[model samples]
Target: MNIEKLDLKSPDLVNENFEKLATLFPNCVTEGAEGKAIDFDLLKQELSHAVVEGNKERYRLEWPGKREAIVTANLPTTKTLRPVREDSVDFDNTENLYIEGDNLEVLKLLQESYLGKIKIIYIDPPYNTGKDFVYKDNFSKDAQEELIDSGQKDEYNQRLIANPETAGRYHSDWLSMMYPRLKLARNLLTDDGVIFISIDDNEVHHLRKVCDEILGEYNFVAQFIHKNNSNKNQANLVSVSCEYFLCYSRDLEVLNKEIWRIEKKGAKDIVKAFNQLKKQGLELDEVLDEIKDLYKRPKYAHLSRWNKIDEKGVFMDDNLSREGGAKDYTIINPDTGKPCPIPPRGWAKSKVELEKLREDNMIYFGDPSTPPRIKSYLTGEDLSVPDSFWYIDNSIDTRWQKQTFNSLIFENPKPLELIRLIMEMSSAKDSIILDFFSGSATSAHATFQLNTEDLGKRKFIQVQLPEFTNEKSEAYKAGYKNICEIGKERIRRAAKKIKEETKADIDYGFRVYRLDSSNMQDVYYKPQDYDQNNLDLFGDNVKSDRTADDLLAQVMLDWGLPLSLKIEQIDVSGKKVFKVAENSLYACFDSGIDEDFAKAIAQDEPLRIVFKDNGFKNDTAKTNVKQLLKQLSPETEMKVI
Candidate 1:
């Protein structure tokens, strides 16, 4: 539950025990194959297939030259121990998370435990400008192959080739990097989920297309163009002064119908206008005005009708929605008129339903001598419909970005104020948020801040690549080490601010997970050439970098796995190995599956097997795994975890 108890200390972790751990993977000893047997044709096809455009709720994934499935299948659904107050990586009450690694892998890692639970996701991914900002990643590359696969020498570990502007395939490269990431991000959202993506002209058009392809364009909510530049140079043919924020709903209409809260001002304006009309000497022994102008709100307009009030501040009252909410008269039911024809707009409550209102003496008939109204305490106020545009001066980014970019002192930032509105509109106070690019963790910041402000407990899951943060910048000059540094710092600052302002109403902390090698140990291969030092280093109990799947697998292990299980292996990312424990146990060792023969013999279940990305080979045949398991005859339970 705590760090000492569960082992999450800090960033020092990567440097401390990691290198020593990489030597333990089952395939590590294979000496790192570098052939690039990846089915380039298939990879291309998948990229072109547009999962978003295709609106794939779920799909069968299969990729070659990599074992993405293996890694994903085994990813953790729950941490072995929660990052409790003692184990907490950031704030004590925080439910936000920061993860470092390829977002695709990170998403796979999160699939099981967090599926369909996240409420919002906001990201600013690399546009894949020809200069590559993203590293081409692969899990199948063994140690030896990793060097070549990365196109680098041992001199630089974190450095990756930036997409140069000259590449003819700039768009392709960026899309390739984003394709899987966006696909995975979509899965993390709850049914009423929503995602906000920030992009520039570089890929805004493409991003929109992709959203249409994946989430269904109908789910597209709005594209807000925010001024991102003031033309420092101002010498170009056209100064592209603004960037775009693309939004999509998991199910837009439904989310919108149930989600967006009304803005306070709008609510008050409505009431104020009604009161004004009453004061204007309109003939009225009536209650609940059937004003037509009330419903005529303009799209994209920030204005609202002013409602009326006398002393206790501005107020507006509209029927909670129904038939006949309009026509009315009298507060005491006018000669026992018994609630004035049930309110034209239809009461939010039914007559029988509102019987309690009568008992509570809360319902008022009306005041011709006064303006009819409903009373709502500001403290108990749910937000009104939030404006779609998220205004920011870049003094900050959302909480996620705040932490992510804090070191850079990048002047402007989008406050969680914006994200909070979106989330509130989605009606998920404690929902999860996902940010693949996770710039400075602004989204994360917003989630935490909103939680504290509203006494809501929204959660967030942010995925950021260990993209290099230039050490020469203002942030680095301030002693910031990397982009993640900026990210973590933002959270710390945001937490402090929230506590200062809101009196610490909710958790403002976060759990941090980084993508790395798998935790599973592969039995040692042939001993190296006889050398005393080599032998000492090669001592048996080796540890590997924890993979996305490894994290997931560990989470399941921590949750307790039943021994009896059935195993099903899907070849989605790699060998999306599913371990089923009757109708219960399900594990996916999809991110690192290759030695399929041994694992097939090792288990049983009430089992289901699943993998990450795409696991199996094209027509590779699963009967082999099924028949092999039965023939081995060793049984308890089997399934995908």
Candidate 2:
């Protein structure tokens, strides 16, 4: 048996596209110099009834470097995310992740593991207001070289090129930068997943067009108007006090079928008060009176209709009549044993359904002569659909951040209430939330806060570029050299504050990872360029600076495994082994591997196992280990890196 070598690179999207086309039209799949290529003319003929021609006018959002952007999205990256144990909160057990890297490369690295898994993506990217910097994806130079060529090292880096409005490619540069990232982000969304992009007037129109092209125009859900600022005296023409959140789904039909509702504002506090009043063991009449008095307050005025209480809790009487004519039926009052008065239209439910409701004591009949009403319990009907307009004050968030850090570290962070509200509306209890453009880690902070409130197991993945802070800025003076530092620190402080307030049992920890070059040396990727005479010069294919943990991380990415899975270190025949997800995968980079160690591990019958190329004592030992595994555990597949 030939042992497989793990391909330590991100997925090749161009080949995947070719395979998809081949499956749809086999006749159009022709062999080319490199590999299977598409016969575009034949494919077009199959798709259309008329003869298809090239260079024909069609509707598309075109811009300078658009083709290059498309190429960049398709290209595979050799970058890897190495775990930072010291910076992490709970490196082994926590499911939450905070990654520092250029989001473009990070998204590509996550394509295999997180594909179609993210339920909600909320990003607060740069508004491109002429002063902000746009990410420039240049594959030609190394990261350090690019940073140096852009400006001084302490200033903005090349990845963040200043796109002033005076430049000729102002709109084009922003579009090119956003196109590839959006394309990659769409791949990570679940079928029913949704994305919320926060933007201002500067590029909302262009961004919407780009999203329509990539995420599909039919998937557009809503363009929410968030009135965040009450004071906008800097405006030239009008008081531009609101920003927008453009929401789109991967598949709108699927999302529409799912219920997207949030608890009514002030509803939870009313429930808590009702529960407290019940705990006091007051009389039912007294309890009702107290609830009514509570609802009279201005804070609970919206919930005044639900002041009535019974053994089943607070509720409001709702109309039981249906509009536009239905089958009229009499609902008997069980208390009076008489036919209750019916509305002019009809009862909303059928006879059988009405009997079910009557048996369940859901109908409220005040008098025998009056029409019966449905008792809509507050606990059962407390949810309401979110609206398109939201008015949240921006100063509230600024104040909270200042209090959390004891210093003003970030400017204009998103409101925690807004993020929590969005998550509650669109996400499930255990859904994965991603924010690739996470600035001060407000999304993660909001996730922790919401989880504490609802006891949810939702996990968050925050990715941010470690953009350098200005030398004279408060963030730098406070010992934060980069944006990622501020983001991570905010999460820590927010988690601490939330834990102290709620004392809730939840996963308040996160694992930190930093993007870096692959752990493998150049020879591992390109062995064809070397000859046997000089092969001994580079004895180990792995990098000298890389450790076992780094290799494990890269292997996980290469094998399409999530970085958040539980990882445990075990001992097998006095050799160190890394077990992930309890035998889902096992890796051991130690040397002196022989038949005894192979037999020891194969007995556990792990689903997959990996070893370093030079870990075996010799070629004979490596060949024998494969044979040993085949005989001992036929189900276990082995690989080498």
Candidate 3:
């Protein structure tokens, strides 16, 4: 039971998010009469032509609850993540996290620690095809009121149900749900980070427009066509077998600077050609000649473009003319003894640069009737650039996903290879990937799979609300109560399988945390209202229901420390003392703590310390403890509750 002292006051998310924005663009931040506020005029100036101002028929996304959604994103929650040790794989050491909660509130909670830290975000949100559940966030209602008003009961006490097409705010409700989540998600992305959102035709356009507004229109990358559900049996009117993945970058300029590309298939063919040529007992030059000749075959016709064979190997000719802008110039053909006809976009290189190409025999002049082209060698490097079209190959498809769960526990779970490709293309070896809408935990499974394949150390943070499964559904019959249960099991199964198969040193583990009300009691919030008679009762403000471990977890969260860190308990002069992050913080919540206990803790010189105010028997004892700490660990900041 890792319950902590409840804190009623929520973390100020709006202010925190504003501070981050101010850090990025200080000129755009200005002081309001009341407090810090954004100067829209200055912000517009900073963005230059990118700013969309004035309501003069400009293109933008609109919905009934758009303003409320923005407010919901800015609104803070008094919720905290309590560790569920039994459900977790590695309770203390894993970098991966599986959070069960409303993702909007969770995103706000994560803003401070995870801001600008995530490398890739891949979310398969509800498609809002009139049957999917649209998150209803009663932004104006407090936690308890929200639960009672929504008529939801169970752990976490939130309502989730499918929104049918018959609802009046069909599209608006869906938009409202997504707007805040996307807005907060952008704050978590690194400058070069990218996001991939999977959606169907139903709301793809709305999703694009919302993303454009939140992530900036300039960052739009591509809408990739994934041919996953291509079976015509499921199509109603047209055989709509393909879905879309709308990719966007946090900053296009930053992503462009990296020059990213996905590795192409057909490397096996290149390897096969090399081996076949070797078997023919041909010399190196002869092998090159044979390979070049083989490329002309109809089966391998795509390779025919590399027609020239030289010391640099099989080479292709590229037109010498520049692309787009033209730089006109004339040059003698040398052999022809006359200048060749200039291309419309003139030569790309100057006379001196062209002379270097000629000297190195990199200019192809075999076609004397035409302008010479620069020679480009085709080495073993068979690279292909990623385009909007993503045709289905054996590696990508949902068949394996359905087979893994065995009961269609989740509909249309993404293929592991599909997500792996996104991670490989967009993230570094040690990147951190996030998926708030992590149905069936496919993103988590894929991340682990990629790590095993490349021996990389990628990590993931998965967030999903515990939406209840139908009582008569396959998942419920299998003893799973909610969607989160199924998602967790999938990850557990994936981890065990990967470990058994690879037998390699990998982090196939995750910590599970459930979002709930803070552990502090109600009296802790309105202490000023209490008279001296109740002062003694309020002395122990920590909730009686919360355990010492719970309070420690809350302190760690309030301090912005990772919740998965190892916690150590030690006995100090007959009292229990807690140490976290290897002496980074120490706390003694037990009562009857004497000067000896305080002295023992202070002697360790921990960086930060916390104690219960009534732990001491009297003021004299407390004063002695403070004096001891002041002398032994003067730098250790102390707090009392």
Runs in model 1 lying further than 4 Å from the true structure:
1-94, 128-132, 138-159, 227-237, 252-257, 262-301, 304-390, 395-408, 411-415, 524-553, 557-641
| Candidate 1: tens digits of C-alpha lDDT, residues 422-526 | 555664665666777776777777777667656876666766655555666676677765676677777777777778877876766676655554443444446
Top-TM-score structure, candidate number: 2
C-alpha lDDT of candidate 1 relative to the true structure:
0.53
Compose the digit string of candidate 3's lDDT tens values, residues 1-641: 88898788999999798888789899776444344567676666677867566445557766566788898889888877777879989766788899999888888878876889899999999988887887788867776788877667787666665678756577778888899999999999999999999998989998999998999889999999876534523656766777899999999999998866766434346456666776777776887777777665433455667666554456779888876524555666767877766667778888788878888888877667777788986655556566566654433434554566666666567777788888877888889899999988989998998898788888899999898888988788878889899989999988888888898688888989888777766754375677877677666766677777677767777776666556778888878888887789898888887687877888789988887777787889888888888898998888776
Tens digits of per-residue lDDT for model 2, 1-641: 99999999999998799779989899886544333468787788899989788666678776667888999899999989889989999788899999998899999999999999999999998898888998888677777777776663543232778988766578777888899999999999999999999999999999999999999999999999887656444667788878999999999999989988887767777778778888999988888888788767544565778866788888888998888645556767899988888777887878888789999988888767778888988863468888787766567787886776677888778888889999999998899999999999989999998898789999999999999888988899999999999999998888888999999999989999989888888754366778888778577888889989999988998999988899899999999999999989999999999999998999899989999999998999999999999999899889999
Pairs in clash, predicted candidate 3: 3-550, 4-550, 4-551, 5-519, 5-520, 6-518, 6-519, 6-520
RMSD of each: 18.0, 13.5, 13.0
Candidate 2 TM-score, C-alpha based: 0.77
What TM-scores do the predictions have? 0.54, 0.77, 0.74
Error (Å) of candidate 1 at residue 281 is: 25
Q: Which has the greatest lDDT?
A: 2
How much lDDT does each candidate structure score? 0.53, 0.87, 0.79
Which structure is stronger by TM-score: 2 or 3?
2
567, model 2: CA deviation in Å? 0.4
Report the candidate with higher TM-score, 1 versus 3: 3
**Clash counts for the predictions, in order:** 165, 0, 8
